[model samples]
Target: MAAAGSVYEPLPRPCAFSPRSRDLLAISGVDGRIQVWDTRVAALRREYVPSAHLSATCTCLAWAPARGIQEAHQKKRRKSEAVDNDDPYDILTIGTATGDILLYSTVKGELQSKLVSHHRKVNCVRWHQDNGCLYSCSQDKHIVEWNTQTYKVKCKWKGDSVGVSSLCLSPDGKMLLSAGRTIKLWDLQTKEVTRQFTGHSTLVTSLMFMPIRAAADSRSPPETTGLYFLSGSIHDRLISVWQVRTEMKQKSAVLTFTLTASPVSIDLAPSDSKEEPMKLAVVCRDGQMHVFEHVLNGSHKKPLAPTCTVQIATSGGDGDSTPKPVSILSAGFCPDKQSMVLYYGSSMQPLFEKLVLKTDEPHMCLIRDVKKTLTLRKEMTVTKVKTPVVKAADTKVLMPGIPGHSATVTAMTVNSETQEGKRKPGDQEDTIEDRLGAMDIALPKPPTKTILPRADHFSVLLLQGLESCDSNILNKVFLINNETEIKRTVAKLPVHCVVPLVNEITKRLQGHPNGAMFMVRWVKAALVHHAPYLSALPDLGAQLGSLYQFLEMRVKAMQKLSRLNGKLYLLITQIGAFQMAQRTSMQSSKQAKLVYEEESSEDEEPNKEHNASDDNWEEEDEEAEEKEEESEKEEESEGSNEDSEEEMDVDKVNSDVDPGNESEEE
Candidate 1:
């Protein structure tokens, strides 16, 4: 099975097959030989030794479709009576390591033109469809345009200060984008620079421009096509999809995407007609090629997610003889063959793999909107799928029909139940293996994020904390005890993640008594205390505002039903307090009356006995009464003086504090 998908060479470049016919395949070897294979029998057709003839190593290659062959033949007949048209001819252009571009015909099996202009190695060569001009970039910091027909240098553009690592010509050929210190968009005719995109931290290694939607064949090319292009870097390990604005002045590079692993190369499987879908395949440094569904709404640049990833994992043998997996050097998708070809190096030979793409709608990648995604997930969904119930194992695998297929989750994971039975008691694998084993046998399982607790947990907390009715368990688990903690967590959440959480949070808060007041206070604190903090986080405060707004709207709707509901509740509370106060006052008055009655009764008996029995004693009693009155007055005066001191302290306190701090009730 591996032998069918794998072809062997010594250099890492996908074999260029004839664009017109799928019969011939071209492979360049490290031994400096280019071999043509007949795809019909999978056998060698012919060999050409370009290094022996030109004395230079081949760096890059491209196939140019022969144009007007019959017309050229008729013109040749006028120059000479004999015309040779039967032999198969290939207008192949190969960039060599020795500062030269070699143009040749495979049928004649000889070097046609040794096009030389660059002072350093030629990095890439491509023939633009619109201008019929072959463009080559080199370490010499120059892009030389050559005549595709005459094989002569037409013009040289020194656009970049540094050597151009990668370049892509727009389909219309009016604009050119080259990557060096930065990604630059250039005007072809006026030769003026426009926008410079510096998002990537490192030099961009690869770039390609593709249409967002496949245009109808009946419509003209440029007007009906899409404007988005993709770029990838080695150090950044990111793929950025940039779109050209409507004006085509090259001022704005609206970013459409940023994802993917360390990409070694990328290829687009564009649809030939509107009925088909567009697919983008990225070959990463890891021995995997990820496929994403590229979709858009009209001309708008939308979200991009990978639908699935496919990898070749058939490494065996040992020691120095064993070939470790190498980075994918190049990959190309040929719709005619319905296959994706990936090239990489191995021990003795370069590995050429032809993977069959499942063109059926079910397996094809799909695009989604920007704001749609689960809040609890850390990774974005690159591809969405419908996993059929597997009665045998209840596991999903890659498409069952793709050519040279094998299991991706590995045999160990596929039969983990049995493997677990063999393990020692209480033994556990390390974190990495434990995680890998836990993964489902699916292409991608969007991982749950650790930033916020589980959505279910959060929702439950919201319901319990916001309720006017209190439940202990719900209060502890769901309540945001510290506003600062809530702010910090919310600040880190992505906009897509924040919106859904806020919706559920606001929804719960809306059902509570005084929920609107609670939300208003919360929003006010966030905006006032943490305004600077929230400003650092994109769209965080806005999301919080959304929560407050939802609560406000719900509160307003309730208010419309009864304007005095809050006032009525307040009145009920006040009445309860007043009744309690009256009950306490009545009890105190009764106690004082009983005490007075006891004192008066005791004194009444003593007063009567003194008045009747002793005339001399009456004068003495009057003197004693005067003495008691004097003592009582002095005691009363001392108490009043203490009360006046307490009043003075209270007045000093009131004078010292801010007037607004002392809230007065009317």
Candidate 2:
């Protein structure tokens, strides 16, 4: 069994490649120092050390996505001379053993911000590509999701009682895989465990997802819903590859293969062909890497064997005949997937090497053309270094606040009315006794005018909200107060609060646009109602001048926007007119076609009428010819009958003649 103290021992230096540029690698060193190197040229780019005392070493490192780089650049107000010229806005996140996460910038070569939410060491950190959300797991059994824009904890949940030692996010960014004694997959949206694997006997140290594009089928769309992941445990000397399917709804994770090695880190290189599985590289503690070619070929019934095992040898010895074997700390593939960068050796003098994959030979796949990129040296120290503190001018340090208003409290007591000097009652002699008795009589009290308090409820609430310097509370206060109430509140505000109010408005004007409109109105009312009081204080005038400048800039922007809107409107109008012209032309063409069709029909109708008239005349002429032929035949018959007496003889003769002629023709 391993010693219990081994669990709390300092982890190796964490290193990671930039998500955007594989040539840029970030490695953490002792004393909370981070170093960036250009792997392509084997050159050191920048090195950053935290100003505060760091007792713990970095446990993990991750580079923020390119989108985060853009965000950092956009948020920057001014350029720093120390910023790197080539890559001016790169951010690297470092997780330390103290359970604190530090955001370091390559541009400024300094720490950007420190986040603390864990009591134990942070084990792993992962970034989601789409939303730029950061997920971190720690030995405190806590998983925290952070919003990169605000650097605030967006969500926190207890992942497992044993504590998570590693984390990997799915390609779709909907599922998360965390490894400890048992590997568990979580649904990020519901924060529920979707699947669990208890194959490993020891804590899993490294977890990585297989590249989705490498396994995608060309016949279908890329399968981002499912992926294979590799998890390694140092104590067990085992690397297990598991496959998740169907949006992480698989009843169980299919273990594709298990490779044996005390893996310090695991990385996968996407393959070019679907027939070939991704190349799995596992860097072991003894400076040995096991490269498996067909480990994730989708056959989970049996474990696949590694294709090649490469040994990493040490560079030189301290004037000795033989050098000690190198101890690899971490290893990761390059962007091209053809080579890898390795960080190894002791922390006192760490070394970096670029290992290229050589597939030309069958037996020896990894070629060690190790290039010495950069070396990190550490010096032992205990004293804490304090940065010099410089106090700013009084004007800069002064913050406006409401001063207490003072008023005198006077009470007048009247016991009796003045008596006439005529001594009405001449009772001067009766005197002292009468006066004392008259003074002793009680007199009715005069009516007192009520004085309202200097501040109203809304004014008090607004003042407290502003003084708290909380935007949400101040926004709520503004939301609840009406325009009349706001005006009254500003008017009642003291001379001291007036400047601060203006300053707050000016600062807010630089923020969200929705609040700026109301803030402008509030500032306007403050200046108008308290002009005399503000003018008396020169500092107040400076604040007002800033407000004016901001408003002027906003006005110019609004005017530009208005001009753009007008141009857009003109374009839309021209398009509408063009469309209208097209419709008119089409309608005219259709009407002309209809008219031409009607004229053609009219011409055909006249031709038809002329042909009908010609047919009628031909019919009349044929009828007349038939009648004339019939009359002629009847007259001939009558003439023959009149000569019947002679015709009998003639008919006989004709018949005889016809017979004779027929015989002769025959």
Candidate 3:
């Protein structure tokens, strides 16, 4: 028997294989091109430039399952119209740097749409088998849902404060699992966060959901299958399984299993086959692949230990000669259930393959096919088994800000204009009366006088004490204050300081320049109220205060710049509106000047023309009489010209028609 926890020597680095069934094997090269090798005679079949223009590395790749559909329709004439056709071979979805997702069809060997919705580098992409939707997560801290048919965004789920590193969909397509530092479960139907599982101390690298069973137990009243979620954490080098019980009122979920190795990727065996038990495949950072079979007891209600474990060799050599194991970036079983493949490495040529138990493993190896032996007995027992009376516990925890302050709470009131309840100004007479009536009779009126805390309260007491102190002493005080007030403030420090504050204090105590400046700014902000001593300690107080103020101003400026950049981006994208606004401003200015000029000239024109109107009217009447006689003569000449043109047109048409008649007579 193999040692209980012995590490296996993996195959050599940069190894490639073609599965026994597949004719073409895809290998991603360091040059950012996918090389397709014909394994039948073990040679290169074709080299496809999926992303030849991209300089960034390819992070992940997945092939969609080929689905066959058969539809039966009734025609308008009462005849049955049946059509059956196999869906096109699943497209290959590749995720790369620059946050672009490319889909390629294997049948056509042509590139499909390039999904460019993600703002940052895309980390992973997964296709939902049942819905044919693509889910992709990126370093932009966003997970996008895509419609595979239309290639349009269906929806987007934003991550909380961190870039998403991995994503997975449940078997039923009802739940979406995503991971970064925390694991979040989303209900696809509601598009709301269902639950957040916080167990990993570091980043969660990968996640997979166990498959649900198909048929209900005959003896039981059709019990629904339970859901199980698995996650890999980098900090603890552990694999955790979480059981999700939707039936429970509280949504009872808990970690069920934890492994020792850091899992980089995980995949569960397809649950379609009744003869094969469910299995989990996990690839670890140590360049090892582990597979475990799911075992069920007689009741088929509780989970048992894995029946068997297989650790495949991925890289090889003695400890001293062997290079450090690169992470297994991704792993998946083929649709035919013949073999599995895994991609590992940080660079472009990261993918590697391993041929585990083949499709014939069950039929050829009798001892290994445990499910086949128990198939008959299991069916008989399952059919006759009686349903057990099980009570589900209430798992609902009160949501924050429901009715009263149950936990930590804070409140802020907005002005009446901003309040959710709309009320006109000066229309609160009834509201005031109702509030007064609701007040307790025994309660005394609160003090009307406002109290301003003393200036000393706002003064930087720590800075005053540290004045003229050495840098070492100031550093010590800063450390102490950081420890003390860290919990009081809600604002999170930047990433560079977070690890030092939370994980390592001693390592950062080396008095770095950045840390010194941070301490000085903090101390200065603390000492602003010491006006009396400010004159005496001008250098310390003034400089520190100025520095503090400068930092604050810089941060505000950055925020403003970000807002301005967003506006500029919007302007560029919305060209029509921007152009219209510019045109409207120009037109308004010109119109304003024209209006002013018209107003000034109006008086001059009216006065000058007013006196000449009587003389002009006499001349106009005489001209009108003479013009009418000339106009009648001109009208008669124009009418004769129009009549002549019409006659010519009619004669031309007759001549043209007569030629056709003559030809027929001849």
Candidate 4:
């Protein structure tokens, strides 16, 4: 719907793409008009106003999968008992301001049922694909599950939030995510709140679950379940991706990273085949639909960066002329995955190549060949949807919830064939490079044909993000675990880019114990790998020269101080020279005594025979007696020494362990 000179406010939930046909788009309008359009051709297929919807506005719409006759045939073949499946959903479910749900059949082109669903405006309705259940929530602060076939209430429960604004369910129908006071992740089977994510600065406006886009990369661990989802906020203008791992003992959604965008609608673009990288389409307050191709870094598989972006023009208008910029309510990618012929990884990274179709041009062009920028234009058609402007006197104000206001999006949710419970990217923040990859710029992407950002741009963005991060995160760049990666990055970085980062690292590492070690290593790598590049940049070469001079001065000063200290030590040793000279004299006297003893022994050897008979016999007898006494004394002394040693050891241990012992301090 369009109004001239006035902003269009789309419903909290506006448009949905058909999962069955993959070509049909069902859009709910404020004028209670449900329009079906062919997504493939961008042509209006049909328009219908449900008689059951009495109100002026259709709040939300969801398309049920196309029901086939095969189910009935199988039932008959198996001889199973059954009643009529009245809810053959080749149909659409519409919620309106009158708290009523209108189920209209696309096949029959008529309303199937008008169920009075809630006490107030029906906020959202979702068709559970797996369990074949329909779920709806409202301002009544309750979520009700309806049996799709019977249109009967299966269950209803009061919610914790005063008004539940949005709802999303897991693909398996075993989990429910509700957003209002806060975002709550609930286990459907246990009927218990499993986790609550609290960082949304405002009311969570829209949310969708996506399997990790680049999860096919080899580094991602085998997962237990695919429970990753993205949530967007209004006041914060932030999008947060979360990973919830169950099946493991760990049970909470870990916030991976944040993107700053004034998002209106977000969805994934339909891929050509299962093996293709997931393409994400996000529509912000800006009218352009930005389609980013998800690519995993080859060095680190878990790191996800939109290496390429292809923006397409989509607005709210009929065919034949340019579409007008209407408030995008919501969008979804078609279920059909298109197949195409392609070649990659031959000097081209998946992150580096992107295909975009320009509005003026009929052909798709590789973004890499384009210049530095591209501008998006929003063109309106000749005819417009005339929505009446409400004057104060023309419409009654109900003043519901203090006369508040409302919130569009488009999405394609892909199912990852990878196993469940794969380790989430957020869990492996073991390196500074990972966090650097996580850091996002606050600046909106410039309109451009070259979606592939220069590596230098990435470096500048990383520097900016690091500049604003907390001290702990800032210090991560210098950490030992990341030093190797940091050096490798430094080796490849242009000198101009490295300058600011060097300052940042130096500032962060000032006075750090390992600062010198890392700096030495970093300098070594830079000099070795980047010498030629640095030499070419005159400014960079001069800066290196300055640092070299500073280091040389420090080294010279240190060497001089060491020499002076060694000379002072030698002077102090001169005081002990007198003791050294006395030891030398004692050594000479000992040598003379040794020579005399040798001469005496030689003379005694000959004299021993002559004296042997006389004095020698007497002396021998005396000597024998003396030897006996000495031996006896030696035996006694040895025994005493052992006893003394044992006693001393016991005393020493006591002293070592005693409470009052002074030696224990030493």
* Stretches > 4 Å off in candidate 3: 1-27, 37-45, 50-53, 67-90, 214-223, 249-260, 270-277, 296-666
Question: Each candidate's lDDT (Cα)?
Answer: 0.57, 0.65, 0.52, 0.53
Q: Give the root-mean-square deviation of each candidate in angstroms.
A: 27.7, 28.7, 36.3, 28.9
- Assess every candidate by TM-score: 0.45, 0.50, 0.43, 0.43
lDDT leader: 2
lDDT of 4: 0.53
Write the number of the candidate with greater lDDT, choosing between 1 and 4.
1
Give lDDT for model 1.
0.57
The TM-score obtained by model 4 is 0.43
Better of 1 and 2 by TM-score: 2
Question: Any residue pairs clashing in model 1, and if so which?
Answer: 9-350, 305-382, 306-382, 306-383, 307-382, 307-383, 461-478
Per-residue alpha-carbon lDDT of candidate 4 for residues 1-666, written as tens digits (9 for 90 to 100): 111211122213366656533456666543346677554544444566423233335667787654621222232322221221433445778886656788775544556667765867676787777667788888678888887666678888876556676898876677898887777887777778887776664556677876543234455443342446777765454456666665442333343322334566667543323355555655555433344453311122132433332333323234525543323334445344322111111101111122232323322223221112111111313122222233333443221211112111112233574355577767653488656666664657778775775644423345544445445544454453455665666665655445445444444333564676666665565566766655443123223433554466568889998999999888878757877988999988778554333336677775677565674677778888999999999999899999999999998898778857676576
Better structure of 2 and 3 per lDDT: 2
lDDT of 1 at 413: 28
Clashes of 2: 0
Can you write out model 2's per-residue Cα lDDT over 228-312, one digit (the tens) per residue?
Answer: 7777775556666677765545444465444444676677786655565677777666556667777344546556656766655
Where is the poorest 10-residue window by lDDT in model 1? 1-10
Clashes of each: 7, 0, 9, 27
